[model samples]
Target: MSAAQRLHQYLRDARRRRSVDLALTLLPWLAPVALLIARWQGATPAWIALLVGLCLIGAIAWRHGSRLDTPWLIRRLNALRTDMDDSADLLFAREEGLRGLQRLQQAWLRQRIETAPTTELRPAWSRRRALVSLLLAALALAAVALWPAAPTSAALDRLSPSPQIAAAPGQPRLVQQALRIDSPAYTALPPRNEPSLEGRVAEGARLRWTLRFQPQPDAVALVFHDGQRLALSRAGEDWSAQRVMTKSLLYRIEATAAPQAQTRRLYRIDVTPDRAPQLRVLEPDRGLSLMTPGQKAWPLAFEASDDYGLAGNARLRITLAQGSGENITFREQFVSVRGSGGARLKRYQHRLDLAALGFAVGDDLIVQLAVDDNRAPKPQSALSPSLILRWPADLGSEATGIEGMVKTTLPAYFRSQRQIIIDAEALIAQRRKLDGEHFLKRSDEIGVDQRLLRLRYGQFLGEEAEGEPKLPTSDSEQTPDDAHPAEAGASAKTEAHDDHDDHGHAPDAKPAVFGEEGSVLEQYGHTHDHAEAATLLDPQTRKLLKSALDEMWQSELHLRQGHPQQALPYAYKALAFIKQVQQASRIYLARVGPELPPIDETRRLSGEREGLARRGDELRAATASDPTLTALWRELEPGAGGTASASIDYAALERWLREHDERVPDPLAFAAALAALRDQPECASCRAQLRGLLWPLLNRPAASVRPRDGGDASDRRYFDALQQARP
Candidate 1:
């Protein structure tokens, strides 16, 4: 091979290039040797220069390439290889030609040996260079040995976690965190002008946040607590401890030195169950619901449990509630329980009676179940099961529903219009009496009932709209059993047990049964809206119902105004609605009708209308106008406590008034009896009743009864009478 080709091949040697490449081959050993020599001399400048040189070389090498082909290393290693007997046959001419035939070798190697044209034979000079090189090598070695070794590096700098502290009784976890208190705490929100906490973990807990103001809380106590983390340290107000690991965690936070004008401060802490025990009230995702009275009911159940064994003596207790007398709408045990599940999961159940629990469906019973886990360190949980313990409303409370105004005069906006004239007149009158404000205030409380009466009566006055579409006749609207007269079963209205289902499922669904010959099923077998057809006395059937109600409301006004006598006819008018409204209203009327409710004119007998008893308002008005009505009024609402004589006077008044002989001129006699009301004796309550008749008879304007100097004695008496009479 050509000499150039050989050199090229030697430089390009792949794996061996690191040990054989040109520049890399020569520089590494030389650089290290130079560095060692300077370092031995303790030469700061030389060392710095070498460092700079190495850095520059490294930068250049990094930017371009890295080849650790140390030339001296390869030369020494190659020399050894050549010396080895097994490898000596590869070369002969190059070394020997250079050693012997000066001219041919020089001619052949001149390009390689560019620096020197000749070799002068000088053994002494060779020995001197060797000695000098040895001295330099020795000095480099000594310098390297004396130089200081590089300083050792260190591990990362960070805070270490600490063991959890013991918790206080009734505490979830007393997590104490060290807060960085470089500055005072202040609120960022309004009331915003307050002190701030420089290093509080959680800004504040929802329920129990106590950031003190004057003498700030303990710098490192009750650090801070949110739902999850209890930060006990700070990174500019972050106080959570390093990440905590546990199956469950509890957090507790509060202020330290809290009471005596403490300054605003914050804290945070975290607790792991493994290191510390924490207690918490196991709460329900939903709340408890119970059945209302007279409603269809189902089973009721309650339960409670805990994490640590026997969060001791966890028992459920029920309260009847102060006002809820005997309204337990259940049929079975108040609290029956079942046990199963790995944990002692006990359920207290009660089969409810749908008729008595007067509670509302959405209302919950505050059934509390308390637990105490008597540990050497006692632990307790305020956990309770907030179960919705009731049947659906359709099955629970049988609800009762009753078939369920302002005006001011104003001047007309336009002068030319007649309606405008009336409004203006009203406006003038209103302004003279009271401003709209006061007038509206009066409207809020006063005489509006009269309008209500008018509307109500007008509604009743309307006939069950003539020719309106009537509901189809069906079993649901009638009693087929009523026609049979000999059915051998309970009325379908009364619920029963142990019944088979025709739909082939269960009788519990309140399934409709086949109609008997004359049963309710037969009568109302098909009417879905039975209330319309079956309720014959309802507004649909009786338009008079509304009128009757109006009369009653009028009667109340009359009675309140002390015109008990005038109130009588209205009472009787009201009494008309008894059968007209419903059986219940009718029953109530029947009960109260035996004696008038200390009202006006109830004692008055209806005069004949040619041949029939006068009916409704005309009759009521007639009775109210008569002396006999005045007499009966006296008896019911006796004046001067004259009930003794008032009763006789009323009876007489009734008889005479019924005589209706305009020719007898005996109306004066009834008048005389009324005039003599002061002579007879009666209790004060009844006497007041008699006096009650005057005002409504007079139709005086109504007024608000303010508390009197006598400390509401009269009002109390009247209200007391009403209470006793009604319930």
Candidate 2:
């Protein structure tokens, strides 16, 4: 290639490298600028900023390209390489049109250019510039991302217009206004002065308002939306009022001038309530822990927090349950624990020595923390979930008799009938030592044990367990049939059937033969009507068991009525019957069903649903709308054709607002919007404001859309191919 062609190629390479360096230096700035714009404006503005940045970058690249043209390259080549004898332009001149001297010069320069290195013609990369640009961009991005949001009240102060002081001629016009707030001591917040009347303050904060009028009025008062009116004390030209902020509300200034009038705008005061303390247990990992061998101490950690300051000390309530069965003893004690940290949050640590608390095997120690906040008069308190440390009892082995028969032993914790009798006898022996009330209480407790033991035996006899026992008037009034109603019903039905023969003969009719009694039933019908033969137990034994249940019931009735002495006789008798029933020989077991195949261990707990389909939940959308709110929105909407002065049902709307004030996001703002619309119904901005507030409160109708079905692999492949074939 000729020198001009080679130089052209060199210039092309230089321009490409310069363009890349320029992009590296400039394009990185797009991210930080876009983020800054997004924070100031919104997403759409950020996109516009990016586009503008790109256009500026392109313009700078064009200017830089113009400065590095062929002429500029020729100058740089001549200045750096004097050996070419300043004849570099001759290389680019058209050879045929050039003069003899120029043509000869071009040929000589081309020969020299090929021998000399062309590396000097290339542009240097802006490495430092690019690095600095990237560093600045990253710093800017971090600063923007970490910037905190402005306070809500500060933003509202900027958005909401200040109350207008100008009024009609002869009316009392507000000249100046100032509001000061002093937060409660518990909050430890400094007092602040609000520039506007509408603002928020902490609960129990003292709020003082001072207002001056251009012309002195007869009287001035603050009228709240809840129908409460506070008369401001007049002192010279200024009127002042002070109150403790307890709840959020809207209020307007009312001045009794020549003609009584109130301020058209409603100011808002929002109160932030103090939250209750929150207690969380951090140690032990789990609520229930078992004591291991040689383990002596249980370490516990707790963290408590409150919006304001917390009380000085927290209470740790420990309950120890010792002993077993009906005689279990529970001892509760409270320990005051001091915590460390700031007033808002504190951490508590305590280690419990198991042996120090008299905790033995088969005993449980339940511990809970109760924390309180610094709210005055009545501090709000919270209790943590109970945690238990248990020393588990030893589970005894089951006894086995001869012939591979297993004898089931009752758990020691379970109260037996004999235990109930023993408890009653002991209470009767201490009756003279105890007061009437204490004696009665002990008797009542024993009665509960007796009732529980009776229910346990009733389960073996196939009796339906009832919540409360039915007490008979007297032992003489109770009968066996009353205790076993099912048996009584079966017996009554059998007697009725026997009175009516299968042949429909009269009661006095003679039999066909002497041995023909129940002959028809024997040949045609099967008989299962005999209640005595229904069970494996003999009739006499069954009768004895039924009598024991009746005796136990009688004992429970007297014991529950606080008469342990009267119940002792029946309790002893029931225990004797139970012993007799236990000593009887012959116990029968029911026949078992056929055994099935064993379960697959691999599939157990695998969470596999091979053939099962998921059931979709039926979600019923909330579509109910308040009629009052809907009507108000319709009237306030643009082009509704309602005049600005159109009459509204203020009473009805007020009633609705009062009923649902809690559900409203900002009750003060809602009330102010409503009042503004009522004051100037024709004002377009007022209508718009009220409409905006009401839009979110109105419920939308639920859409009825058919769900799309999930297709198979073949269907998906077909769709993918179709998309690929699209233009």
Candidate 3:
């Protein structure tokens, strides 16, 4: 390449270097500026600014380089590149006389440019300046990143249009006002004061306003948005008003003087409603619990929390499902929960005995803690999720199919009792080594296990009692209690049918013949009625088992109260009772019946359908006998608007009902009225008819029948009478 081409390249290279150095110098400044812009206008604007800054820096550097043409390059070369003594300019001259000189000078210039060190020729960067700028920028970035988030209120206020406050000229102006907020004692919060009129307070807090006008007004009153004005009593030169804040409200202070009326800024009272007490089951940690073999009582540990305080309105609800399959019966009850601590926080614990809850061996117990707060008007309650405790069916027997090789005669839970004893002994041995709290916790845990085992055995007895069938016999004939686990095992093994079952009888046994196995009373008996044959424990045995469970409960309570030493004696006694009861022979008596006759070779097993129609007529005739229920039932039907067989004086009934709307004498009558009203509320005439019908119920006394026996004989009679009396 020629000298000019080389020099041009050199100058171009120098320009690029200068641009880079200038960019480096401006880069540090650019970053912070971009970041600052980003803070206000977002990343897009910051990026735009950075791009503009880099372009400007590049343009300036390019302009400087563009100025350095061949002549300027010669000058810069002499000044910074080589020691040409300013003669390097001659190398680019194109004058006619200087052509030869130019050629000779070109050679010298080419040599000088070629040999010139690139470092000196290239643009120099302000290293210290750039370094210092970078350091400052890094510090700035760190500060920005580490800066705390600004208050939202301050930011919003800055952006919002300020409202101009108009002050009355030469009037008694309001100067200072303070709102003293005193929360309710239940909240247990100290009184607080806010300089501004607007403030938030807990519900039921008392807010006292102290206002001082420039010149004390003759009268001052607090005006609420609801138009209720409360006059402030005078205290020295200031005016004050105290009002309990039951709900959120907006109010302003109005001061009246001789010439003008002054009003303070409008303020809003923010009232926070007290939340309902919250219940959290801490121990079980889950909504479902499975009692391993031998567990008797549930050790419930829970927390009750409220913003204010618990109103001591907390209870443990227990629901027990009795029986099995489709015949299951449900019973519910509420028991008091212990440990009602203060409003902020309270830990409660209660050990519930399955026996006490009326839970049977295979029954499921659903328990939940319900808590209410001390809110006025209407208190709020919160119920924890239900915790289910189920005593699963014995694993030994099968309801159907072939039996397994190993027949577990004793229920699985029986072994659980032995495990409990082992656990209790282990806990006792470790009690001395453990700290008081740990020791007590361990002891209580073992006590809970003991209670559970005791209840397990107790349920065996309870089930027998519930399952025992009542037989007609003399008082001298002892009524055996079916409350034996061994008997339960037998029933389980036999897969015994329900009391209502026909026991392989023909399907024609619609009205099942109830009788003991083969007594002469079989024709008039319903002994096969499983209801009659239900199992029960002997009364004496039942009482003993109940006492044993009670002792176990005492042991648990004592252990939970942190007295392991005191609980041991009761625990031992309960165990001893359990053993005694286990040792007792609970012989279940099987009823004997005559052997069946040989079946006829030519007969089929088909049932006789002959007498069904007559039997149904008899059943209907029996049902028609109850006149009151039949009349009530007829009146409740929508189609029976005026089909009453008996005369009812509508005018007199309407007048009576109007005079005595609350005095419905019959429970069924009240139900009928409600049903009629619900059936056709919009029909005025129908409503009047229902009201007329209600008068009879209001005038008539409640009807009740004492069942001759515990069976459905009384119900059958009542239904038959009702059917016969139907219009």
Candidate 4:
């Protein structure tokens, strides 16, 4: 390439880079702005803004930005490119009349340029500046893309002015409205202004409106769609009205002046109702918890929110399972939780004690949070998802051999108690060989062990230790079951066998099923073979063992009373209850959690909001105003009565039908054919065929054509003469 061509090409590339930089900067700003517009639901504004931005970018990119003239190129080449040795000046001189010094210099410059490489003539690129601009632009674009989004519709409308009002044109006659809505103090809402005619406002808001009509009408009234009208009291040229906005509605302005040019324009109002409280669990991160042996407490945390605010207090709904396996009963209690945070958001937390809930080693507790909001008509509530806190069977421990299998597979918790019963039996058996004082002391120790074991069993039925008749208390309030702790089948400890033998009954005759569907005996009933019993003990054998444990308990009690004879029978009974509870079966109780009110998702943000009344107004305006045309149109509509009238102007009707509908034939052409047939009655067959074609046309109703208001005098005279000549 020549030096001038090289210089121009480099400058053109530089111009393109400038355009690219401009577009990059614009893109970062434009994309986010377009997103915001879309979020606001402004489709027209988004499209218009997008089109304008694209045009501006295009002009800069392909036209204005790329305008690199030869003169400007030469100037840039001389200033930036080092290889051009004053060749620009020599090149410029070639275009002008070269006098003495210029001609000599031009010749020298040409010879020097010829010796240099074409690469030397090319303008140097500012790579560092371009790279920096691209990086900064990319960062800005990413930042905009990653920004947190705002809420939709209502929130967007609140921040930005209505595009319709902003884009409305200045007209000779137009209705404008300015609304101020004062929310009730109880709602804790502030007053708001809307320049546009329509938007949502708080229910029970006091709405004040100022209506201005250009070319000023004399009187105006707000006509509601529900057949109610509120007359605006005039003050000078403006009209005003005030009313408490209790419900949403569509309304229009009906204006009247001295000359009576009736004018109408419509608007809409929406009322936003207060929303219910929402509650969700925020901590522990899981719904179900299988607690370890040593876990003392559970961490409880929740989040609650309401559109208005929260009042009173939040509560933890606690459901405790009060037995082992299938016979478990669920008991629920509401415990108040300390809530922190104002109106919008609140946090609730409590450290729940496992022991206080009367949970045994095999029992479970189900819990959830409940929240209430201050809304009325009726206050609303929300319940969090249920969470389980269980003292599960020791499935986590590793053990070996048949003993290990028994420890892992059986109800392992009560195995120690059975050992205590055996020890007591052995001690009672050797009582005759020891001294009286020593025997009494050891028997007393065994009695104490027996009471402790009974209390441990009692806790599974939500009971306290022996001698402590009341249930335990924790941070939360507890409501005990109606049945006393002593009555829970473990009551055999309180009454001796002597009383049972004489009365034929113990206190509280009802048997404790121990979380089984029936008696532990019933679960293992029947089956006599040792091999069968080894596989699994039958219910009858289990019943016999339970009877033996009851006897062992009485025997231990008698020994403690310094009478070994009475203790032997009870010691046998103590052996029975232990053997039954240890059988290996899958022990499962249906976990019951907090009972929550069913959520009505359909009621969310439910309120009255209508589309803009202007769209309906446009549709009404486009409807035909002339009654004749309207009636004709309706008659021609699908499913309309198809009756035809003889008086109808078939020619005019056909013309109207042909103009409005492509399906109808030309009435004027049919008229000319029939008229020609009338004159040529000599051809009878042709005339008959024309009459058959025109018979349906003759039956249609004649068009009631209104005379033209203004017409040419000659045309009017000719039409008058034709009317006069008609018979």
Candidate 5:
């Protein structure tokens, strides 16, 4: 320590040693009898003054008074104390004398010091270092004591103190004042947020949403339907929701009708799962597209995502079908994102090579996408919307419809194709399950390729359920579900006298084993494996009818290729022979109807077989009770003439009319009559109506076209008169 500093400290301690403050007094050993020192600064002066005063005599004789020595002084103080104690015992007989001596000694020391020049001694800071120290101390004291004095006007009450004492020692008075204070209570929480939807979805009959989860176990997702109180358990961490069929794969989720606005399936999973497997595409909607010549292979992409705080393990099967019927598939390719992986719609691009698919102009491109997650929780499965791309460069002017797709309904096409695939699959499964008792029948759901279904009505069926005809019998007997596939063909044969004919696989039928040279059984198998009967057909008869079919197909193809006149004889021959095949098949004819035809007529042809089998049905109904028509039928003489049918055809009269009339009337109206003479002419009233009015009408005139635009175009009568004048 600095010398002056040490002196200052000593002086301060010496002063503290004499202070009467209770807190100060509690520290007894701190009292200085000017005997010695502890942690003192500037205390020598006080010690010097006290010594001089107590000297009582000049440093007597060269100050050889060793009494000034600290140790010597201590000894004298002790001796004086002993004498005083003895005197008090002998005279006053009070111990108070010695006790009072110590107290008085300290008091007297304080008084002397004050009289000299007392200094404030802080318990912390040493006092009286110099003028600077004193000023600092004063300023500190002022700031504390006078700090914005909380206005004492409305003052604190003074306590009367202990009755035994004049004042309370340690406390300061109180007062009332308002001070600015902080509020540590009310608080507002922020609103919740989520990621937004990023893109568009294709229009299709069904939309499906698959939830993907992470594997290593994080949390679990709890999904609720629109307003179901409890969520239905789905596959794994995965769940599926289907729309009628869903409109688009992409649907933005807004506020859900849940207690909290935050709605999501919560799943507990980790970033990675050790044994996660690729999601099974077999879960649903898995099949290859039916490729047409020059058709493209499908190109696909998928979105697989996971909950926050976990990794989304997506396995996308991206495939491309180019023009040459070649297919490129990217399967089980892993796509991963960590922690609340995002679900923003991102276009994962793929291009199918035109040459690869063997596709030419006017050919369709079929693209497919299969997606799934390979995480621990139930993996998610998704089939992206199939895209039909038009290779405009190749299609040229021929590009139209779904291929060129100028105004094609893509969603419809996809739905239809998928449905056909689904149905075909269902038939195979059903056939694999059941035996020969079931087969195909005509129904509303048949597709456009009627002839493609078969030469007659179907693939085939092993069993026939045509029970013996009864003489109008009893009360109530519903027709049994026809067991024979040819029930359809049988009706057509009898009708075509016009055509019927058509199910699916018979599980016990052993697939009608065949070599691939030219699969008659396979073709039949497909027919049975379609919706023609919805699952009831035999395979053998389907094979036998194949040759006849080739002929018919070639004829139809030529006809379609603007060679209808060349196809005329073939169409007629096929019709008659196909009918014979159907009739001989033992009602075995059956078929899986096409998915849907491009035209209504195509649908009906495939479904009912030939031109309206229902026509003869209408004819029968027309003559059943009408006397005039019935009489005509009876008198006309039927081909296989008999009273059983109670009908006939006036073959001679029809011939005479055809020879005499230079021109026949609307030929279709006289169809039955002409066929009866040239084919099967009958004399029912409707037939007479045709011969009587239609043929003569045809000789009258040709229908006329209307005037162009607005000029000379307003006269309906003029057009009609012109039409009448054509003949």
Candidate 6:
């Protein structure tokens, strides 16, 4: 062969060697991955494992083989052969394309390569790495082979079968059983069969049970835990029954021959419910958005998710609220927007054109997204929270005073006291239509609005904003007549002041000055002893305002307690008092200092300290403990120690649980525990379960350090003698 042919053969051999080395280096790592996939699938077929393995090998070969081309082999050959002068590429090139100098160099290189060894051209292989990887792969395979397999339907059936009862030798025995589940169409799941009688299925799925018994009984039926029975019709040699799964329950098979008998073992069926679609708005971060000038379109994005799948299209409810106040007009329109994403989660986006929606200044464009899940019969739907795009109205500036003071009015969106009263009345009217929980929630929301308004008004009286008003004191709890005695006294004083104004002068009254009236100290001195003297209103108006604040406090209290009906009376009274204060005239007068009363020297240090006693420390009683729960706890305590009761009054304990069920963390679980304990009185675990459930319900004692016990008589006498000796 020529020098070029020998070089070509050598390059071909090197490429094969490189491919083999790569395959060997990668096989161990890829084998573990394929094995892990097969194990995760749980008893995957051999054909599937083979196909996955072939695909992985093919991918590795195609990716690594592409790098082992002729140019790469030539580069390796040049790097290994020092005498070639880096002209290995010329040997592969066509002789006709080679120039004079290249031709001369190729001839020289070919002569040198003809005698060069081909073994030196092969790529280096790491024998130690390959050996270690092979060892690890072998160990991994052994571990996987020995690992316990996941439990299948057949295994479950073997573990939980009908109880073995010793009956007559001719009694029928269950030969074969099969449960076929047909899931709902919306779930897009194919029908499947399970050999186990106890299995979890999707809600609303149809379950068909088929059982063949040797020497068939006259009749067969399924008895459920809820006291319901389903009879199975005889078909050929098998008994079959079908029902739609709705809830989780336990059931047992019953067969009747000459003597009827029910299986002692109960089969459990767990149902997974279909959840409603949840819609979340993603574009507008806040519920309320202000429209800026020159804005043309409002873009909205929403995401809806469901356990099964979301519908193809979602409804965008758009409501245009125009104008302001009671005269406002609302125009509602719904737009269908197609969603794009996986079946479980879908995203819908819509860009609303401002011009098409007829959005204008002083108008609000409210939009909410409504989505439905792919549930059959009637799909459960959800509505996103309403997002308002407000185009605020322009309020012109008012330059009224010489200093150009700009006056601003309250926002029109601010809810007023009258609106609160109206909402309370409307809620009362709709109480019969709403459920108890929803009604209470609505009442509480209105109460929150009322509290915010009360806090705003309190700002005028220099009161700090608080979450809840202080509980009414004994003085505040009195009737209006008794609570507002200052009103009566102020009215009487006003009448006397009016009488003075009517007459030119009184016999005992001094003449009034223009700036300094009533007393000479009032014009120059400042006194804060009386709250009414520093206000801009007269005593009578201040009293009315104070009464209004107290009424508001009462209204807020009842409203927050979900008693809108009881709060209406206080609300109306507060409104009436507020109206009176609004209509009262502002009487601006000079600051007045009170006249000093003459000191009584006889009463000042006479040492006649009668009717006075030192203040004593008052003690509050701790919360009372429930005796029924205590007795139940004592009876349920584990182990044979500590005065544990022999028997418990379960009826009394049940009554107490019913009364305080709201306070229990999980009342249903607690009831289940009680029932379990009652049915299995001798069970130790049952007793422990009941005790655990009862422990949380019992009243927690105050976390105070236990007081040290009083010493014996002799120790007390010694301490007393020591005290006497010290003196």
TM-score of 1: 0.16
- What would the per-residue lDDT of candidate 1 be over residues 387-423, giving only the tens digit for each residue? 4444333323333345111113321111122222233
Higher-lDDT candidate of 2 and 3: 2
TM-score of each: 0.16, 0.44, 0.31, 0.31, 0.15, 0.47
* Runs in model 4 lying further than 4 Å from the true structure: 1-177, 212-220, 226-228, 231-240, 243-248, 256-263, 324-330, 376-378, 393-727
Q: How much is 358 displaced in model 4, in angstroms?
A: 2.5
Q: Number of clashing residue pairs in every model?
A: 95, 2, 47, 35, 100, 0
Q: How close is candidate 3 to the true structure, as a TM-score?
A: 0.31
As a TM-score, model 2 comes out at 0.44
Put down candidate 4 lDDT per residue, 1-727, tens digits, no spaces.
5645655566667677667655655554566566656555567888888788888777866675656566776676577656555467666555468788777766666554556665433334556666676677666657656776544434322422322221123322434556767776657766666777677887778887777666666667887644579998877655788888876666666766412222333467877776778887877789888887688888898888887788658888899886644577998998998788877789998888877877776667899888887764467788899998877654545334456433444332243555655656677689779988988877665665555565454433332233323223341122245433423334334322232123222234367579775556433432222353343444554455445445545654675676655664565556556565555233334689999999868766885345435434432233343343344334333343224222234455435444543332543334434334333435445445544544444334545556567679998999899999998
Q: Which candidate is the best by lDDT?
A: 2
Residue 685 displacement (Å), model 5: 81
1 versus 2: better lDDT goes to: 2
lDDT for model 3, please.
0.63
Error of 3 at 150 (Å): 32
Give Cα-based local distance difference scores for all models: 0.38, 0.76, 0.63, 0.59, 0.35, 0.73
Superposition error at 236 for model 3 (Å)? 5.3
Give model 1's clash tally: 95
Please give, for residues 367-461, the per-residue lDDT of candidate 6 as tens digits: 99999998989999999999999987765443345845444664322668898899999999999999999998888777766766665665455
How far out, in Å, is residue 492 in model 3?
28
Worst 10 residues of 6 by lDDT: 497-506
